[model samples]
Target: MLSNPSFLVAWVFKARYFPHDEILNSKKGSSPSYAWRSIHNSLDELRKGTRWRVGNGRRIHICEDKWLPTPTTYKVTSPPTDFEDFPMVASLIDPDTRWWKANTIRSLFLPFKASTILKISLSYNLPEDRLIWVGNKKGIFTVKSAYYIACNLVDTVEGACMNGLPTMLNLTTRGVNSSGFCPLCDKAIENLPHALLHCDHAKQTWSLWQDCSVNLVSLILDPIDIALNLLEKGTINDLEIFFTEFKGACTSFSLHQNPSATSWRPPPLGFFKINVDGAATEDSGNSSIGVIIHDSHDTAIAALNKVLLAPYTIEVTEALALLHGALFALEMEASYAIFESDALSLIQSINSGVVGGEIGHIL
Candidate 1:
């Protein structure tokens, strides 16, 4: 349980001691078994191992967790000024995008390590940090989903993991013989936002969607931003359906498709990220609002949930929920922040500088 903590084995030991903490934070009891102490020594070695399976990054330390992917301590040669400032790898991640903080990493570590860090593709589904046995070249003991996701990452452009199918523009950069424009409609240069969103074929495909046709009109943002809007405006099930349909559309567009493959990128460094959402009961004319504030370290600074007595449209409720959260943040003096919501229409209105409807004053 202590050494290979997974599922039930890890839970039992954790419950016994350090229930609210990690195995790394546990101490040997007064009369501990030989197994307990043995695991402690192994944990120390893994901490200094060459590669650790990255998850939410709440457990591993930055400098002291030298057993980075390279495993050769030479990767991150730059000495850390202080270990206390960033005790865990969580500080290295951006909570908003759920990806690594590139700027902060480049500023902190050497080029070799920083490059490795950036190449490490994160996942859209935020999972817990896991382990891959030392000397396991094939990552046999690692999470299967993450390994598959890593393979998919290769299909994406250098920076965007959710760029769908590479357009003629990217193909030309790779020395393929073709005009760098849309094949279906030769009017514009084909990029990620254009290939899957702005293209005439893509537009027609999305037009077929029934439940959320409004999203079809609001396809001005990148896929990642669009995903965030969907999550805030709709539910997980809704997002799943959208992605499934989107994948179909991309596949029909081209065989070289990389659809619904997403990675968590953290919000910008030194910025707090707030995720706001609302749910309403049509029968009761009541709604509930949820707001959570997290710093760059992925630590929740504050969180709140409120029940509204009156009924309101989904858009208005989401806007009100965001307003409530923003006010809460201001009360606590969290100025530099990136607010996130699933309400695409509300966000579009705010971004276009054309606030309207009931939430115009709030915007």
Candidate 2:
């Protein structure tokens, strides 16, 4: 059954052949033994060995060929106990089998034993620090899974398990349960659609951009399929918007989850970094806005400067610094300049294009 693809099909057909509750409860001992004994008696004819037929019973044969056809099966059974069994198993399997050449299959089997080690380490509450070195005799798969499981890390979102981390399968850890919540909104926890499309707040935001033309409700009904469709069509802009919406929804959810229910801060559009240093004691609020432009490298390409108007509030000082920098960039005939500030709200307000607020007037 393990060797055949057809066995899974047969499993569906034979699912009702046994009484499920009875099969689940029956054991070799502890309970009344009649049910198990009857099952034992029914299979008594094959007790001698599957290799031979005695009495009027069915017969079965055990050969590696029955499981694998064409090439005679190879055997390398005498591997050292400490070694991983896969290398030997792979060596035994037909060298020409398509699975043998695939990198995906190789990766899948390499961790067969590592997963066991991770579970053991996690069970005993071992220290959580340190990268799990693969193939180290000191480590196990179970412990590695535990370390990953605790952090809720996953490889690329659509992984069975994180590359070296554990998965939801490690249910032994605490505070995890099987509930479907929108990755965006957690309030009336349900499916992705409910959180991203059906949520009143989310719907309003999406409607603002899409104008109800995108069939968001239906798309949300099968977000995964819609997502794949977008990808396959190479609709990069739509995908970006979907991701942005999804992130917004999640942030909104996280905020509501807190006891005080603070509202979410929308993600910043861009940053303008402005660094200012001045000494107030020496009348050296001779502040200068040092504007440096670099092309993604720490090396400076251009440096420009301006004097400041205020030095009291580092807030006021930075505004003057940016104003000077902005005017300088304009004078130098540069198209745009990213203004940065240590004060978050000020930078955020400007980046968001919400000028005419208090900080806007001050600057």
Name the lDDT value of residue 156 in candidate 1. 32
Candidate maximizing TM-score: 1
Question: Best by lDDT, which number?
Answer: 1
Alpha-carbon lDDT, every model:
0.62, 0.36
Q: Which window of ten consecutive residues has the lowest lDDT sum in model 1?
A: 251-260
Task: Judge candidate 1 against the unseen true structure and give its global Cα lDDT, from 0 to 1.
Answer: 0.62
lDDT tens digits by residue: candidate 2, 1-363: 111215764354235333242222223444434644665454322211111111111111112211110111111111123324333223322333311223433343223222211111110111111212121122223345344433321222333212112222233243567444444455665433554457766666565443222566445544566667767764665655555344333431111111224332322333222233221222325334556443333334456665543223344445555655666555655454455445455667667764332224333
Question: What's each prediction's TM-score?
Answer: 0.33, 0.22
Q: Give each model's clash number.
A: 14, 22
Q: How many clashing residue pairs are found in candidate 2?
A: 22
> For residue 51, what is the lDDT in candidate 2?
17
